[model samples]
Target: MNGETLQLEIKDNIACITLNCPETLNALSMRSLIDFHASLKQVIASHEVRALLITGTGRGFSSGVDLTAPRPGLNPDDPDELLRDYFAPTYQLLKDLRIPTVAAVNGVCAGAGVSLALSCDIVLAARSAYFVQAFVNLGLVPDTGASWLVTQAVGSARATGLMLLGEKLAAETAADWGLIWKCVDDDKLMQEASAIVNKLAVGPTTTYSLIKRLMRDAKNNSLRDQILLENECQSLARKTEDNAEARKAFAEKRKPVYNGR
Candidate 1:
């Protein structure tokens, strides 16, 4: 699926979603968010896609919402409407996707952009890229799940500082603070992200899906409940064809080939 502000391409079982509006540093307008939500639905409905990667063209991953962009019938002055109608659903779709999701941050990720990147299962950023909580600068508080996502990754203290100060957080520092999976050189960012996505695409995708669910549920579950959930998930994983193939391959002393069943 493709649109003016976004592009979606699937190849070798991996789906790549690119933010195409580079002129404004890939700042997402209402139209772009609509396109993005549609593209994600396409990915979810496709059986051929096993892994998903999100990135952007030219310079940045995304600079967040374009407050000045026009959307018919929507009140621009009321941020609540936009968040309820667009941003909330999009982020929920991403979080609930059955397949693994990766984000490649190529440049500046500010405001909601930071939440978008951090929402993925794994996030990799270019060494030169940085994140900023730009909302405070506009006299607004962080929205689009930033308040929760940031606080969950880093501690409350760091998240508070970032949001209140609206200072740039370097990619390397983000990694060190456990906000992202890794930070690579600018030229190698795509390469690393592609490598990770490709690996995930060919692995036991059913297991990955279960793992993703378990991790998300773990945040709110007590240790006793989490253990039960893991046991249940493991039972499900063990019933997949890929698990049988893995056992057979182990006995044969050869690498297992997964069909992502």
Candidate 2:
């Protein structure tokens, strides 16, 4: 899928989706959001797409919702409903995707942009990248799941500090705080992210999906419940052709070729 605000490309079982409005620092324009959902839907429908990566095309990952752009005609007192309608589907789609998703943040991520980056399964930020919660500065609260994602990654204290103070966290500092997976040099961000996606693409995709499900739900489940889930997942995983092929390959001292069964 292609659009004025986004670019989508697929190669070797991996899809790369780029927020393409570089002139606006790839801010979350309405068209961009719609295009994002369409691209994600296409990727999720592709059985061959084992992994996906998202990044921006210019100097910044994104600056968040484009305040200067025209939005839907909603009553000023009920703006929440309009924003929700535009953002929720895409956010839900990202969370529901079965295959792994990576965010390669090449530069600044602020406001809803921070939410977008955090929505991915793994986030790789460039060394020069920065994450800013600019909502408070504009007299707004974090939206687009930023509050939940930030707290999930960095705990309430740090998330609160970021939202309240409107401070920017450097990528390295974010990594140290467990807010992102890793921070590579600016020039290496895409390459590193590609390597990660490539690795995940060749791995046990079903196991990865199960692990993702379990991790996302673990906080709400008791230990016994989690154990039962794990046991069930393991049982299902063992029945896959890849599992047996892996075991046979080990015994034969040969490489295993997975069929993603």
- Among these predictions, the greatest TM-score belongs to 1
- Which lDDT values do the candidates have, in the order given? 0.94, 0.89
Question: What residue pairs are clashing in model 1?
Answer: none
How do the residues 116-150 of candidate 1 rate in per-residue lDDT, one tens digit apiece?
Answer: 89889999999999999999999999999999999
Estimate the lDDT of model 1: 0.94
Clashes (backbone N, CA, C under 3 Å), per candidate, total 0, 0
Worst 10 residues of 1 by lDDT: 70-79
Candidate 2, 1-261: lDDT as tens digits: 678899999889899999998898999977788789899989988888999999998899999999887665646787676468778878888988888899999898998888888888999999999999999999998889999999989999999999999999999999999999998998898889989999988877887888898989896899999999999989988999889999999999998887767
Q: Residue 83 in model 1: shift from native, Å?
A: 0.8
State how far residue 89 of model 1 sits from its true place (Å): 0.1
Candidate 1 vs. true structure, TM-score = 0.98
What candidate 1 gets wrong by more than 4 Å, as runs, is: 76-78
